[model samples]
Target: MDAVSDFDPARYLSDDLLERIRGRAAAVDAGNVFPDDDLAELRAAGYLAILVPRDLGGAGLSLAEASVLQQRLAGAAPATALAINMHLVWTGVAKVLADRGDDALRFVQEGAAAGEVFAFGISEAGNDLVLFGSDTAATPQPDGGYAFTGTKIFTSLAPVWDQLGLHGLDTTSEDAPRLVFGFVPRTDAVRTRDDWDTLGMRGTQSRTTELHDALAPANRVVRRLAPGPNPDPLVFGIFSVFELLLASVYTGIARRALDVAVETAHARTSKKTGRTYSQDPDIRWRIAEMALAYDGMLPQLEVIARAIDERADHGALWFAKLSGLKHRAVTSAKRVVDEAMLVAGGSSYFTRSELSRLYRDVLAGQFHPSDPESAHSTVAAAWLGPVDPA
Candidate 1:
């Protein structure tokens, strides 16, 4: 048995569930369709409610377990994995709201138990995602409610969201821009198209949602003085777990690439040498290098996961470290995919080869929120103190 099979982070998901997810991804890859069946399989497998508290009739898996499932999911289909990433974020924030005595928490929790899905609405049309703030406006309503009027772009899974979080300027506040977090069900507003058809992660179906004169109760609104700062820092910061899982997914893809490369080398005959390509020392070195990379990522992920589990009170430093880890994970994925492509030679790009699929999926994380440049800058600033570039 391989190490990944032995690790088996998804004890909750039966063999039937795992196979079904893989099959769905395969079908989506072939047909270039939305992973509706994949999401349904996850919901049926109880992964959609993995983060909900046990008292709320959820599985209540730990961060480590969730990370494992996410890694496995990414290995199959990164676009689907990226889309569902919002669920983990929402679950973490929802838990924090519950601790703050917010009434919306229970409803969200209940919805999770019922397999209802929520998506994020952070990045807007003109909002500098790295800094924050969009043109979207949310005005406090007369009946102790709020009216959300804005267009949100890059809203992953918007077409299927049951609950969505909108980040807009709170008209009631005067000082520094107030980062208002408002929750609204998709059924409450009209959605428009952002129509994200990119070079990679094409199947994510990320689109824009426009909310005009949408009414939201006070209980559902979460006002944060600073973005990404939740009432419960510990729970919210655990998203680093996703980063570690992403590393595992990249490693798995690389490992598969190495396997195929070795098989092809042994089978294909070199014209000049009249011998197998595997006989060449350069080919052997690439295989060894790939193995070394996969081995290194696994332990690092475990170390970080254990740290978060042990120290629930990690502060800004934790956020910085999580950012750094995510950067490293994606960077590793980039290198692994690049190396796999080289090792596979021209065959990696062949339409029929599995390496072609893995290569495309691996590049998806290169530009995610956890991109290396921003993450490294955040970590460096934390370490060297914030720079005043006046």
Candidate 2:
């Protein structure tokens, strides 16, 4: 059962489906493989096309609705939710652009409705200049298309993605140092390495992708913007949706931990007091802290996502807000999971325990975009101004 009761994920996700996903999560994680079964079920339910317009044969949900659904899904299976997030992010970006009167990503919305699975391919090993720069080479073809040749790590949905939405640096172009955003289909030039061995989120199978002259055809080449923080709608759209969706996932994990902790507190009795841990002051306080953190996230996430959908202006503070939200969700989730472990006592420490799995899963939250250091720096720059190179 989910922690949230008032909202029903806009009816896009049914409780039965979520329960089925939850049932498969442990097995998937144990095998260290992708959740192919879950994916098939989600696709069959038209969940993949939820963001696509109704005219395009979709559920036509808003960003706020999407966030709620992602949270609900994450509560059941964090890795499944995380992996599907990549696909939803692309569709969500398309929605953001369409709302701003930019149809450059119209193909993405249409593609989603047509049963295509898109994956995110942006991360590079040793490259901290995320979303601002790229190490991959974007070579312009004679037909106005671009051929990408480089590696992208942590490519989620690695096993089943039909399209890889990625970016690369195009130094050879007329506008030198431009970052090219495009999509490439799986071809001989593109390869996915089976190197997804990890401590947690093992079900994601977020392997490394090798692009050796992988082509993004002219029509699919979406945007070419100069590197560094520009006010392009694409940038804001990606940043806003990515951060909000990610926060939703971590927040869901925290909610799950809190629920388990509550259950443990009521079910376990203390030897000294001859009563349940629910009566203990320390356990009660811990549960309250977890509840407070989980409660705190929804309002901000709900407001921000609704604001984006409504096209409200946050101006320059948008990045700071988004980054801060992601950071808070991750940190709070870690704290909640830690407290949950303690409340459950020694049995929770076992690998077979649900709390044990959650503990491992929540750790991956800190590793996502907007890490603690970067998030603090962003918030600091927003208020105190950027640091001087001198």
What does candidate 1's lDDT look like per residue over 1-390, in tens digits?
Answer: 122334555566566765676566655666555688878877887777887889997877555556666666665666677777677667654554454455455666778889988777766654545224557777777665667788877677766778886666674655545666667876556575757666556566777788886766787775544543444442343245445555555555555565667787688777888888778778778777777776676666666665655545556677677777666666676676777677778977875666777777777666556567678777888789888899
Candidate 2 lDDT (Cα, whole model)?
0.90
For every model shown, what is its TM-score relative to the native structure? Answer: 0.84, 0.97
The whole-model lDDT of each prediction reads 0.66, 0.90
Candidate number of the best lDDT: 2
Indicate the residue-level lDDT of 206 in model 2.
Answer: 95
Ten residues in sequence with the least summed lDDT for candidate 2: 1-10
Best by TM-score: 2
Tell me how many residue pairs clash in candidate 2: 0
Candidate 2 off by > 4 Å: 1-7
lDDT tens readout by residue for model 2, 240-297: 8899899989888988999999999999999999999999999999899889888888
Q: Superposing all C-alpha atoms, what RMSD in Å does each candidate have to the true structure?
A: 3.6, 1.7
lDDT of 1 at 286: 74
